[model samples]
Target: MPIYIYWGEDDYAIERAVVTLRDRILDPLWTSFNYTSFPPEQSDAAIAALNQVMTPAFGAGGRLVWLMNTTLCQNCPENVLAELGRTLQVIPENSFLLLTSRNKPDERLKSTKLFKQLATEFREFPLIPPWKTELLVQAVNQAAQTVGVRLTPQSAAVLAEAVGNDTRLLYNEIEKLRLYAIEQNRPIEVDTITRLVRNTNQNSLQLAAAIRVGDTGKALTILADLINAAEPELRIVATLVGQFRTWLWVKLMVESGERNPGAIAQAAEVANPKRIYFLQQEVQSISLRQLISCLPLLLELEVSLKQGRAELSILQTKVIELCQVCRRN
Candidate 1:
């Protein structure tokens, strides 16, 4: 397996994987000669990488060529595709070619299809959306294991809730907790995580929750705290939009007399069918009309922020309006 495809929005995880691959494939003594990297700035980087990977290592270790942040899987020129087809067929067993991108490989593209056929591995490190608590918990557990630390299930959940979908933060927190555990000489518990992690109780998801129940004051407070913490305004809007959009879909499905959890989850674009039960309960008090109305206000907020309006004022006003929409009789 000499060819690898790594793609996803979780760039930190992808880079970490690349580092591990580099260590495994390149001999430390000959690393300077065996490793070649192509940043996206270089024109025809894919072709250059493919050409480089064809050459055998200069010394004892295998050759490793990395095409960083490549767009070949998204859109490849016919010439590059032709070159890729040729190189992949004869890439030496001891030489490795790695292509990484933040976007998923477009399955419809010929380049992606070719890579799928020839690449030894296709690994994705997608960022779990903040609303997916189960997946986030699993991520926390996985990172803890990799860091050689033990975490109680309750502590893992707490850590997941604190870090959300930020892979880098999750790993950093786990490492910190590992250190604390070593000092205390005990497995990580909820109290240690609570003491070590910053802003554990506040997040944009909480803002969405506050808005969902029509608690204007609480929503405004959470928004202020997030802003104070230097959270990106656009990112906050993105999370709110995704949360409301999911709620709207679930409510629409349930109102239409759809009972199957799998069907509802599919329609709502939720990864886990088990989450449908919780989503159903969330929107039970709020009307579908309310959910429908929240999206436009949220969009307006996004546009206002992007247009360079006063962030604090615009956010407060739109959040109030969203709360009002949900509060309607």
Candidate 2:
């Protein structure tokens, strides 16, 4: 429990866990001195936090050094790794080092190997697949409870389906539901969720699904809706990129004779391994090279958008080009 490594895309869960650590370790009144949060945005942030972890706590109570989004999981410089290894030896019992990241620790990286030795202290909250209604429902139900609001399983299911599996967005939606429930002085109902939740309106998955099937017309329509909804172009691009990457992984795994759906899904970072069977059947018809062609086009699309050159016309063209590969029967 002294060295906790929490890695996941679920910022909501990660933040909650971090807060729990803070409450359990740091004195409430001396929080300013005992608790420290180091996000990845600052240069040399992880190195600085690692140094602090070895320093003994000042005054009374324990010290918490939260190293959020630690890049050490990547190919960290040998000097930093050496210093971290040394610091770990002297980290006082009253001091804690909490490492977190959005992506899982890449198994290929040597840095991950060091962390692997401490596997018992590591916690991973992977991406829950959008198709896993039960998991989503459980997430929603637990979230509602956290906010002191009661939510029906049906209502929870509705929210999960509409919003997909992004816990950050789910937390925001939960706040809104709680506010609405407070105003009404009642538990959340499916009708209440249907009226207040705008998840279907905000989600861009339909666009990606349409593009996957090469339904250009539907894709274009969905894109228009997204644009009108003021969704950032980069967000839409990210969603499509993730979908294409998943398809490519599934295709490659099947070609490599990986029959275990759980293994493939885990490698692909899909939370719901049961859904991998469907992903397998879907990608079986899609050629590997055909899927590979979409990556460069998508890269170009992202670059053009970032350069302010990819307009609706350009987006339409590139989207169609990317989807064309899936059309191969």
Candidate 3:
């Protein structure tokens, strides 16, 4: 049989799909499961590994062969593609081959004889971002429910706020929350939600807080920590920009006489009410026109860094400089 493929846009659904596949395929059919994952750059080695896995166990019932975490389709070299196409053509029926990726296969490969044959013989499931908030909530709830933990509406809403659209991080937080609940023997109440679900790495939050407070020294300190953690400079920039935007919005909401921080934070999905203070300050410090103008400059900086017009470290420096300037104005 040809290889079955499953892919996802982000880590959570991708991981769930892998877990589901493993549960469904293993244990029932065979004694031994042979699984391997390949990096994108190791095309030749990946092809070799696949061959080894698909080579029958000889007189045994069969084996499950898996290639996980590959980016072959996204960045495969021309010569490697030709070799892969040949290798894929002859996978035997006794072995089950599965390939999971975060990337879609190349269009050229999709049209090739090998991919066509594989597509005809095996199933392909692509994991997409949840189209609705209910879907996203259900996924988190299901994961929690499996662990005998339940989320209150407010807690679930808080979790959603912290996660935004990053289900991978959401799932990770859920796992942590589940473990914490089991250990502590407490229901996930609103106060518990405030402490746990809204939590983030102190550095990321500190950086955001510093930007909100117009504290260049604090922002730079947090930025350094993020960089040392190997966060991409571009990601840091994007995150800072996002926080600034939120601060501007919250400030506007407050100035318009919205006294309830919870209501304002709820609208923006900020789980922590205390965050309102910093957010309100950011709005007060700058005008709406200034915030609007700063966004494009930040975008240009991102483009320059990614396109090699600027070094990553230099880009971070520029980001700090720009934010400091904004604070002054």
Best-matching candidate per lDDT: 1
Measured over all alpha carbons after superposition, the RMSD of each candidate to the real structure, in angstroms, is: 2.8, 6.0, 7.2
Deviating ranges (above 4 Å) for candidate 2? 39-47, 108-110, 131-134, 183-187, 200-202, 208-219, 228-314, 318-329
Q: How many backbone overlaps does candidate 2 show?
A: 0
Clashing pairs in 2: none
Which candidate leads in TM-score? 1
Ranking the candidates on TM-score from highest down gives 1, 2, 3
lDDT of prediction 1: 0.90
Question: Tens digit of lDDT per residue, candidate 3, span 11-62?
Answer: 5665666676656545544444444444446646566666765576444455
Question: Order the candidates by lDDT, highest first — what do you get?
Answer: 1, 2, 3
Clashing residue pairs found in predicted model 3: none
CA lDDT, every prediction? 0.90, 0.78, 0.62
Candidate 3's displacement at residue 292, Å, is 3.5
lDDT of 1 by residue, 246-296 (tens): 999999999999999999999999988999999999999999999998998
- Please write out the lDDT profile of model 2 over residues 114-194, one tens digit for every residue: 777653378887766554455777878887788777777688888887776767777888898777667676678888888
Candidate achieving higher lDDT, 1 or 3: 1
Clashing residue pair totals per candidate (backbone < 3 A): 0, 0, 0
